[model samples]
Target: MTAGRAAMLLALSWNMKMEEEIKKILDNKPNLRYVVTEVGGKASEEFRGKIIKASMNAAINKNIIGKNAYESHALLHALSEAKAGVTINSSMSVSFAMKVAIVRSDHWIAVAMFGQSAFHPMTNHERGGFGIMHI
Candidate 1:
């Protein structure tokens, strides 16, 4: 892997280790089926790489489905049965993760928000079902 990619992977691992609280939250939610982290396009190529790798790692640990390709429909199916979701898109920021999680969860899995405030651009009315955690 490129140095940048390696750095991202390391960073992601570090974040995972550091965020034990978050992991605990996920573990508590038995219904949660998947955890997603968006690979933001603008957040440096290295960060994006980290996001993807981190997401894969989270998937393995959480035993959830990780979508790296054409599986939107399948993802949605999994989301419907899931307890929670984690997304890392800068477009809507981490808050969007809450939106995505809430919309997809069938068992009311708690949502954990991460990322920047810039994600706030996403309004509640546009998508609906953001009852999950805000941050």
Candidate 2:
């Protein structure tokens, strides 16, 4: 097997929990906050945007630029609080997200996954959500 493939496998097999993931990041850099979103699509964006806005910053502005590179201005907008922010959207599914999260050893990665009971009506597999159907 390829060395890179072996490394990826090792990372995926590493044991870690949800809260622990964030905590690990926070532990390393207490000055930074995390915005956990799914890999792509509108549903994931809207779902995770809520967490970013309500929990991270209330003032969602137009300063966010480009097709990607979101949260560049958002971390700055928070004002006199956190030093920096990072958004992790490595995967759309819970399992894949966890795998990606584990894959990265130096930096923390995260994904917003809804539980089976607490489903968001706005979230659908077509729109990049961890739903019953896959696109």
Candidate 3:
């Protein structure tokens, strides 16, 4: 295999292992809400946009963003980052918003959310071209 392919395989393996480890940890603590979504076979702007919109809507519908002007501004910034295809890792407990982590490989981009149960609905929405797993 080419070096690039080898590296991609390594990353995929590592991510799968990490996901399993995270699942085990979350399983131990059932009280904490955890939602994971994966999009297989490369990342696209459309998929990213959908995730951004869904996440933003979830935050807004949960009253996490609008309650405080500062929080709203922060979320807007996060949305911009998402739009730019930047990875997100925010974990503010008071906002009722979900933290997003994007893991990418040569063939896929996986988005994981950790927060309220409301975020769970955002998973498994990519219609086709991407394989989604929610756990």
Candidate 4:
């Protein structure tokens, strides 16, 4: 693996291990599916939005069809009835990780509040959602 990729993986593992609060919240649930991603780049907001949305769809799709979601209109016979009803994902500023976790479900997660986010502080909206937490 590339050094950058390896570093990111290590950082992700470390965060999962060190974040007691997140572990407590998860409580080793056997059903919920979660994702970890990084979200800071020079790309346009439109691009970022699409990436976030697609990632969510793909994660959920994999849970059901045993493959990536293709936005198919045809009926997909369930390979497995099991799927996550709710999804949880997290992003943090570490060696390499998503800057923030974005969701369309109209809820906020974690300590950051950035662009187009409902939660805010006395700062630029675009610069919002960058709150740093150990979790």
Candidate 5:
């Protein structure tokens, strides 16, 4: 892998470990708040956006920026929060999102992503998502 790719992987791994540590520390505390949504497709954006607004009571704007840095933003959001829940489209995105969430925060659980998951392995690495499901 190129140096840049290696660096990104290293950073991701580090973030995952840090999230775990943070969760362990916060588990002792009481009353933590969090939310989760599956972030994909055109309809998904609307649903998740509504959820965010309802949960936070604030309007959060999202722009289509040619898919430049999804993982980074997701990871940052995960790390900044105490607990998080994630909903994924299928087994492929589930796995990818789980990895992202794990790197962001330890207190995360992916809804599902085990059976009949077929993804374009090459593209998955860069986009951080799975392609399709084949049963």
Candidate 6:
């Protein structure tokens, strides 16, 4: 498989594992809620707005404020950076970046994935899904 496909598969696996872990944690604390949102396609204004709206609605339904909601821009940036082989430090793996982004966000509302190929301004891949959630 191509490197990009391989990376995407690995990311999917990692995300699945994370979902399991998050589930366990949440199970222990029913008072807390975890919202995992995904937006896959070229990052457009409309797509971003959709994610923002989804996140806002989720937060409001859960009685949360704007500050408590999280966006996945940092995660997307880290994935891009990792794919580009840009490392900030020795421990700056893609997984590390993802964890950091999630922690910083606290309540991630969006996790946008752009492009199937890792090419610059990745094009050709058909847009798939918008503001998907795994809550």
Instruction: For residues 56-107, write the lDDT of model 6, one tens digit per residue.
Output: 4544454433343233343344334432332222221112112111111233
Instruction: Write candidate 5's Cα lDDT for 1-135 as tens digits.
Output: 222222123223335476455445444434321122222322244534533333222112221111335533443343323112233443323223332212112222111111111244454432232111110
Model 3, CA-based lDDT: 0.37
> For candidate 4, lDDT tens digit of each residue in 89-115?
212211111322211111111112222
The candidate 2 region of ten consecutive residues with least summed lDDT is: 126-135
Which 10 successive residues of model 3 have the least lDDT summed? 126-135
The local distance difference test score of each candidate is: 0.33, 0.27, 0.37, 0.27, 0.28, 0.33
**What is the RMSD of candidate 6?**
12.0
> In TM-score terms, which candidate is top?
6
Tens-digit lDDT string for candidate 1 (39-106): 33233445434544554455445544434443233433333222122322334233322212211233
Per-residue alpha-carbon lDDT of model 3 for 1-135, expressed as tens digits? Answer: 222222222223335677566546544643332233332222345545655666556555644344566554555554454333322331221122234443222222233343332224454221111121211
Clashing pairs in 4: 38-98, 39-98, 112-129, 113-128, 113-129, 114-128, 114-129
Clashes of 1: 8
Model 1 stretches astray by more than 4 angstroms? 1-29, 34-42, 66-113, 117-135
The alpha-carbon deviation from the true structure for residue 51 of candidate 3, after best TM-score superposition, in angstroms, is 2.0
**Runs of candidate 4 exceeding 4 Å displacement:** 1-20, 43-46, 53-65, 68-135
Who wins the lDDT comparison?
3
